[model samples]
Target: MAETKTHRVTVAQRALLLSWAGVTDLGRRRETNQDAFLAEFPLFVVADGMGGHAGGEIASRSTVERLQAVVSAGDVNGPAIEKALEQAVGDIADHPETTDEGTGTTLTGVFFAITGDHAQWVALNIGDSRVYLLRDDRLVQVTTDHSVVQELITAGKLSPEEAEGHPYSNVITRAVGASELTAPDYVTIDVRAGDRFVICSDGLTKELTDYGIQHFLREHRDPGHSVDAMLAAALENGGRDNVTLIIVQVEDEDDSSSPIEDTTE
Candidate 1:
């Protein structure tokens, strides 16, 4: 047998081998984009702001900035992320403008890290914004909708179809800055190649069905284009609310090992 030379790729290249894109829209009726989110390292989020004036925009931006600052200042893990969200929510709630009487926002965040062969991601959500995963051409909702209809569905008082048309469908049961203390639901998932993540506000999901989303994702590879097409579809139906989307495609980090994670805080 002849001896052969092998090349080793650096860790930096492997760290960011994948690409992603995000988009937000004010819809046909809204005058401004009240949503804000982060796409920084190890943290990604989509927040839907609520208020009459610019309060929604302010609250959304504040939440993202606060979380980004906290994670940048120290370490960001499951517990740390939770604490950061709690503190941020408290601070935002303390604002006179973002109270139950006025402004608020719904936050949905995804934190992830890849090391060696293993990858771990966590989702923290407050409000009705959603996180979804597409695997094997199937679209599965990763986070539960935190709305009044969702509560009714869970309690067996309403069927899925009934909840869809419920008059209070948009009335969320939980949201950041709505109260002094808010608990965001956190979910963790292992990573694999060919897995796609979709984070969006209700506007996007409301007008499109799961099958519609799956078809669009399967048809479009560019995250940016996918979001635009989805937004257009929403408008075609009836752009009643704001629309926002974040799409991330995960591929094999290496041909060798599994994904990686640093749970160390």
Candidate 2:
């Protein structure tokens, strides 16, 4: 099931009406879902765990729980994120199963931040998971994947079309846990009206093309519907891996009301 919520935040006298939906599925082949997400106010994150057995699940769940605490503390910044990640690293290491299996997880998503003068979207990525933005009815990938295929593509060695069936497509260059932890690459985007952001794990990408993603987003106005539509398409397309995704829609307005939160299962 997808969990959906709405929030109205006021920052720098600016109002942003945000609605979002998130879901994680085991897919057709996976026995256990090693994906987790937190879709709370001021913060949204998706983590894709890697390793065998319960190691992956533990790594991902611990990471998101630590990050959720950071947001629950009432402030968010680079240092705070770093500290939270450090704590998450310790949590992952504490699990003997994870250490034995060399488990790890990919972290990615966006946070609602009030910078010095205005509101902005702070996107962060650590591995193959991705964050994309849809603005002006045009979709753009915001975070680059830290993977073997991505590195090859950037090096001009592997063409985008040829990289599709590459056996190394699943090999990520960075991760949170496993043997070590890596800092996330961060990006800031100025908030705008009618901006829609998609934070998803590579499982979704493995099944759907970019055009297919954009098409569904263009057809569905409600965040929950958008998430559901995409998830269904991914499963129908093979669902080769565990799938997890979040859709966040933002609208700008002056009539800022108190923060409102609601959930639908």
Q: Which candidate number maximizes lDDT?
A: 2
Query: Would you estimate the TM-scores of all the predictions?
Result: 0.83, 0.92
Q: lDDT per residue, candidate 1, 110-189, as tens digits?
A: 77754445557787788889998887777898898888999999999999989888999989878776454577788888
Question: Clashing residue pairs, candidate 1?
Answer: 115-260, 117-258, 117-259, 117-260, 118-258, 118-259, 118-260, 119-259, 119-260
TM-score of 1: 0.83
Let me know the TM-score candidate 2 reaches against the reference structure.
0.92
Off-target runs (Cα >4 Å) in candidate 2 are 11-14, 254-265
Q: Which stretches of candidate 1 lie over 4 Å from their true place?
A: 1-16, 90-102, 113-118, 253-265
